[model samples]
Target: MKNIKIKYATTFTIVVLMFANVSAQNKSELLLQSKISGVIKKMALEEKIAMLHGNALFSSGGVKRLNIPELTSDDGPLGVREEIKRFDWNSANWTTDSATFLPNGSAIAATWNPEMANKYGVVLGQEANARKKIVMLSPAFNICRMPLCGRTYEYYSEDPFLNAQLAVQSVKGIQSQHVAACIKHFAANNQEIDRGEINALIDQRALREIYLPAFKAAVQKGSAYTIMSAYNKVNGYWCSENDFLLNQVLKKEWGFKGIVMSDWGGTHHTAEAANNGLDIEMGSSGPYDQWYFAKPLLEAVKAGKVSEKMIDDKVRRILWVMYHTSMSTGHPAGSIATEAHGKAAYDIASESIVLLKNEGNLLPLKTDKIKSIAVIGDNAIRTFASGGYGAGVKARYEVTALAGIKARFGKTADIRFAQGYKANYKASNSDEQNAGYDKPDRVLIADAVALAKTADVAILCIGSNREYESEGHDRKSLELPFGEQALVNAVTAVNTNTIIVIMAGAPYDLNEIKKSCHAIVWSWFNGSEAGNALADMLAGDINPSGRLPFTFPATLHDSPAFALNTYPGKERTTEYKEGILVGYRWYDTKKIDPLYCFGYGLSYTRFTYSGISTDRKTYKTGDKIDVMFKVKNDGKIQGKETVQLYVSKVKSSVSRPEKELKAFKKVLIAPTKTATIRISINVNDLAYFSEKQNKWIVEPGDYKILAASSSKDIRQVAEIKVMR
Candidate 1:
């Protein structure tokens, strides 16, 4: 009787789950039918309006009668943010909330590998699911418009094509786990200086081509289910209430089917933001009732200022997202910071470490070649897991560069440590910007130089701290802060064979030590395994294959945005006077040289590009062109190569960049082996945003297709005629 009862219970449980699955599918279909409409009709006016604003700091109201759960969201584009208090921004102090700190957004972009980005999303999605979050506010698609933008570490690349491709992959990975990926800071949230009030006065063409492409792709290709409105204003209106951006471009033109949620404290008006297309308002200060979309929205609906249909539409979209993700369907519970997630993070960091300069093969330091290795700088021992009131994750563990090197060669090599310079860039109560070590620390610099003089090779680990690069404020300049420049120069003077490992997100002026330093490596603020990954590359356990996602201008003024006075506008509004010329495009077009070009990285092993071929000499619209090239790993080691395909119009009526990246492929080849890479690009990719027609138009003309390793390193060129 007991055995029979257990058997029956097991059978009953399976049947119930099966029924639930079927019900979920039917409910999803019903959402598209009159059932959702009927459910909305039954909801009271106040309840309907309540669903549009946050009931807590990270969640919105749900209709209990309809069995819709509150929309649970988590902060961040990199990893799941640390758990917060129920009704406030304070930490919840939950041990389970600790996550696998993957490489920062800039580090991921440096990898130039979309497959890794997909894996990045998968792990992030799993973590979010583990935390019971229906939506992961991630896969931030904001372009790297300026190096000084405080949140540069959170964004991807300068180029729209590269940013779009990686963003799409990340979105696909997140949504695959039945979690909504919220592409954030929608539409020209570029700078952090007066972010809430600054108006980005951009023209339609520049907006379509540069600032908006990644978000567009996140919706169309990634199938992202949610978007977050930026805090800043676009043109003349806030992003939360800008109909031209939210309605005209995002929804109607690009066919974005997601719900648009306002950033924390981002919504200002109830009726205007609601009617414009904001589906949810999140994170207003004080009590929930004080939110812009709370009592004000309820009053608006009661007074007939905002339509009932608008409320219904908002609720419908929110339900649609929940139905697709956590609400209707059941997801397998996942664990945070699993071993697999750790490996993925390590792999991404390993690939993303860029070897900017390795003169005399100074890197891959043969463990046996050196006796005493001097590791100097405060960054060598710092953990970059969380910082600066931005999106951050509390990692279970973080590997600092010093720890990693010691773990790798501690047994065979004697590693000497020196503080070098104190990194005091942490924001303060009195003065957030200039509080830290902005000037040279002579005492610390003297100690570091003395230590360097006694070592075989001095490794100077220096770069920006969290305060200098975090969200909420723009950097004062692109210069290295906290006495890093003086420290590096002093240390290098003592030891000419100094190796510089810069831990920074955006580009910095390397002109100080570029000529004197024997080698330089850019190790972005990679997550938990950051130190271990750096050790692997320095010890030659893995080859360096990362590339710069943005150009390192010789000076800040070399950047078109700064050079043309387009950034940090006057009278609360800034014009994109430089237009579409950004990053490498500006450098290439104006003949202004950059310290390091975009897509520039050096590997331990060398690779050669040859056998460039095109599918056909001529093509028309709606056609595909296959650009084939063979990459040979000429060195005596296995390596990967990023084949970048760029296209330029031979002659055009409208102003355009010298060349734009259309397609790219990352491939690995064994030693002395050649791999043929075929990158297919649609003829439509040649289209430029036309102001006259207010649409993307492909002009009939001859185009030059170039293959290159970096923007400045063109390996091959071919001409193709477009007869439209």
Candidate 2:
């Protein structure tokens, strides 16, 4: 009798789950049939209004009920965003803290390997779910509007393919934990000038090809639960209320089964946003939501301007998402923890940092007599400086280089400190912009130089700060702050053992510093345990394994589209004349030299790639080509290798990049050990977005597939023919 009862219960559970799975497949079926919809219909106007106002509420360890409605959210993709921000009780229902100080998205994009990105998402998800957050408002896909754009750090890259691939893979990882990922800043929101009002008047060709691909890709492939519309207008209509953007392209063509949430302060009018499928007004509580969510939305319904069906659809989508996340896979919500999260962040961030330049055999520092170490730059001590402004810089802990050194070598070692340059630039809140701090103090560099003369090694930490780079404003130039270059020049002159570390969101000009500094590390704003990670790399505790996420141009002027001027600016037009030639592809195709190539990073260990062979010499429309290469460690220490594969179209309608990165992998090998890697490529990898063709066209031709350690360093070569 006991066994029979247990068997019946198991059968009932399976049938229920099966029913739920089938119910989820049909979006409309769930909208009409789910009990959540009926409850929504029975709700008073105020109760129904509450569902559309997405307020920031904290619940960790388990679920919390709200008399209003409970919606969850998190920070950027590199990690779970901090949710301690306070909300403006007046206008926006969303959190006003607006500062979760997460690492920039471009930094993740540089890693190239999707698995690494997905790993980042999973870790972020673990934290979000543990905190009872239902949405991760990140995987920012904005274009790198300019080399200097402040928010460039928030975006993936200038290249659409890399951005789309990284965003999609990351979303899959986050959703794996039952949390929703929002692929954001919908449609041509590249610039910061008049961001709340400027129109992005892009032609359809550039819009569809360059700006829209990533958004489309994420919606089409990834498990994106929501999309936050931008503040700016696309063409003529604001993104939050754009009909074609919300309905035609997103819903009809791409079939994004997600809510359209408005960016903080992005809602202009409640009715306009709602009619366009803008489901929730985040952060706003005033005219749009507080009043709108309460009066106007229901008023529209009663007036037949909107319907019970429409309101029911919106509420059902919200409740269904809640239910799905509450019981994701085996674990329900609230399983994430803070333990090991900081450590895991350190590991991933340590791997993400790329060694841009290592010269004179100065790195992997020999520590016998190198006692006196001069640590320069204000950033050496500004722990939270590595992350952005929103969510307010936080971690259970931070690993500063100074702490790393003390932990590794103990306090007995001689380590002198100096602020190479002061980060005191405080521009006014608005463009009358002349207020708090004037410029970076040059006298600080002179003081650091004097200290450097007494030390055997000079560790200079210099780069842009949160003030100069974040979500709202864009950067103006690629150059470092005032006197930093001169500071770098002075420090390296006194101590040739100088290693310059640039801790920033976007890439900066380092030509002068490279000439004098024996070694250089480009550390993107790493989080929490960033210091320990940097210290480990500096002390040779771990091998340096980071690659450039975006192309490092010799000069900002050298960029192909530089002449296009201020993008999405007050002028309302930012032409993409370079078309699809972005990142290394543009530099390679045009035969121009980048200061540092994309997919470029240095490791303490040496890796040799050889024995290039393929499963076949030819391919058709849907065939996959397996290209294999053997990588051997030639260095004394066991280390990892990032094998990058480039697929070149020997001939094309338009000239191609000298070669394009089709696929890559970061493989680990033991000292003197050999590891084999095989990467598969599809037809999509070989096609180009032709403006005239208006389609991704693949020409019949011979293609050269090359395997290399870096973009410029080709190790082995193979060939295949495409027969149309």
Scored against the true structure, residue 62 in model 1 reaches a CA lDDT of 86
Q: Residue 40 CA error for candidate 1 (Å)?
A: 1.9
Residue 108 miss distance in model 1 (angstroms): 0.7
Tell me the lDDT of model 2 at 281: 73
Segments in model 2 whose C-alpha atoms lie over 4 Å from true places: 1-49, 54-68, 77-103, 203-205, 270-272, 284-294, 302-308, 326-337, 385-389, 427-442, 566-570, 654-658, 689-696
Q: Could you give candidate 2's per-residue lDDT for residues 98-183 as a string of tens digits? A: 22223457667766667756766776776776666678887888877567766776688777767888888888888888888888
Per-model tally of clashing residue pairs? 0, 27
Minimal lDDT window, size 10, model 2: 59-68
TM-scores of all models?
0.95, 0.86
Report the lDDT tens digits of candidate 1 across residue range 586-671.
89989998999999999889988888889999999989998988889999989878888999998688899999999888888899
Query: What pairs collide in candidate 1?
Result: none
Q: Give the deviation of candidate 2 from the true structure as CA RMSD.
A: 6.0
Compared with the true structure, all predictions reach lDDT values of 0.87, 0.72
